[model samples]
Target: MEIDVEQYKKDLLAQGAEVVFSKTKNLTDTPFSYCGGCGHGVAHRLIMEVIEEMGITDKTIGVAPVGCAVIAYEFWNIDAVQAAHGRASAVATGIKRTNPEKFVFAYQGDGDLAAIGTAETVHTCNRGENIAIFFINNGIYGMTGGQMAPTSLIGMPSSTAPYGRNPDMHGYPLSLTNLLAQLPGTYYITRQAVNTAANVRKCKKAIRQAFENQKLKKGVSLVEIVTNCNSGWKMTARQANKWLEENMLSQYPLGDIKVPKTDN
Candidate 1:
């Protein structure tokens, strides 16, 4: 006999078991615009899920930069603002300062955050802005063609670096999360991935913690997610995940780089 998936889910719910999958109220019903196998959709869903779970969907605001996440305003049900290339952090800072009661976050990509937005990011963290910064580090400019970004691995190939990124020519990849961790203004800094089930759970927890830190009026909280850009990498979704596990994780290990010291 064929199992009734919906009936099984209903039976589980009747037994007081939580639903493992459901659409978050903070996210729109419209389909995602991201490429197939891209991690952006997953990240978006996770963030929205956290916000919904925290019951802050109505009071949270998101600032999206001019990268693949630029159109986030369309997907997120909460109020969202569009910032210029690499300016999401600055915009988020302003929003948080003006509306301290609201939860403000900036969602950005590697190219937008590590390249053109470097100064803004550093200064925002240095000034201790009470905001959450979600940095999606796919290592390439996924939106505007696959160009070499500041976080691209030494030998990763992009549209701009067809023969692989040369250290001599492109310089070494910027360890932005590590650099931010050293800044006194930052309260929490972590590097996470969404390529696996375990990592996805960890990533969701990290995002929730980051938002919780913001609620405490703490300094800047940065969650850098090392994701896969299958289209940009010129690899299938499965191949991209395998490559990310083998290559990207080594350069950007998953873990908390910094956290607040609790008083014993």
Candidate 2:
């Protein structure tokens, strides 16, 4: 049964059925290379949609480093540059400073941001650089053989901590987003997720607000997305999402941690 796709869209439009969901042009045609149930793809879509909606597709620059989202440049249609492992935030600092008029952001994973790039990430926000950062915290290191990461919750098992994460042995999970929110240079900070439909909408709103801060020239705006690493966790997509909701959210709760002060 052959069906005409364009004509099908036309028929739906003729019936007065508005298309509420469609791929934003800010994304490339490249299919996501993430695992079947990983949240990076959904997180990526939210960011690109925000860029498109803000009409900054051409004026935007994104920096992605190592980990699961290393090939992010291929997915986002806007101008982007790849940085060395754990150097995305540092590189983004340079890019934003040189092209101060352009909107810039860094897309990084847990290991890349909270672990190796800890110094750069903290310093970038400390300086209150006018840029947004999107951090995806999947708990474990997804791309590097599922090793333990700085954000891995206590008692979570990983390749490095097969017995389960122990604070005495592995150190407690570092709530990086909360730490950044305390920095005076940081203008906006929030933690959100894409595990469910309702959460996805809220996460999208957070992403949009992060980008808007750039226009306002506010300091650093960070949005931490608590996500899942299904393959790394040795669980099916469905099982991983369920586990994420049960465990991950408890350590990294969703909602705004900091916002610009209102002068009423």
Candidate 3:
């Protein structure tokens, strides 16, 4: 007889087996369109799980950016709005100001946040808007072709930078998270990765802290998850992940940049 994994897990839950893992209720059943081994799906699950665990599923409002996560509204069960390219931060600001009681967050990619929305991002944190920002930095622009993004490391090859990214001609990789950490308006700022189990747990904790800080009416909280873009990078998922470990981590080392005095 064929065994039913889903039903088996549920039956085990009924028998009071220690709950190892389960899908969050805040995520829709729609299949994700992310490329194989892409971190977007994992990121979505973590965010939804946090929302579900916090009992804020109803009061959460997400602003989706114009990159790979442009269709994020469909994947997330929570109410979401689509922002123009590089305008998620600006749009989220208006949404949060209008609905102060709701939890507001903007999800963006390197191209959208560091490149196009740089002004909005800087001003939002500087003003200390009571909102959270989830940034996914995959080096290259995954959607709309693999172009060289502001967060792309030096010498990284991209469609825009065929030979290689030259700092003299292209400028250095932009560290937006580090920049925002220095701003007094920013209450919490951390960078984590999703490639390893340990890092996933750390990222989840960071995300939880981000939302938790909002209860204190603190300023902007940024959680930057540095991930890999296998499709954009022209490598198999396994190879891309290995490359991310060797190269990406060196440039975007994961850690907390700023935190409240209580955490300090």
TM-score of each: 0.92, 0.93, 0.93
Per-residue error for 125 in candidate 2, Å, reads: 0.5
Task: Report the lDDT tens digits of candidate 3 across residue range 1-264.
Answer: 999978998898899999767678888989999999899999998998999999998899999999999999999999999999989999999998999898999999999999999999999999999999999999999988899999988989999998889999999999988999999999999999999899999999999988887788889999999999999999999999999999999999989899788654
Q: Put down candidate 1 lDDT per residue, 28-134, tens digits, no spaces.
A: 97789999989899999999999999999889999988989989988888899999999999999889999999999999999899999999999999999999999
Error of 1 at 230 (Å): 0.5
Q: After superposition, how far is residue 145 of candidate 1 from its true place, in Å?
A: 1.5
lDDT of 1 at 130: 94
Off by over 4 Å in 1: 1-20
Off by over 4 Å in 3: 1-20
RMSD in order of candidates:
3.7, 2.1, 2.6
Backbone atom clashes (below 3 Å) for every candidate: 0, 0, 0
lDDT of 2 by residue, 1-264 (tens): 999988999999999999998898988989999999999999999999999998988899999889989999999998999999889989999999999999999999999999999999999999999999999999999998899999988888999999999999989999988999889999999999999999999999989998889988879999999999999999999999999989998998888999889989
Worst 10 residues of 3 by lDDT: 255-264
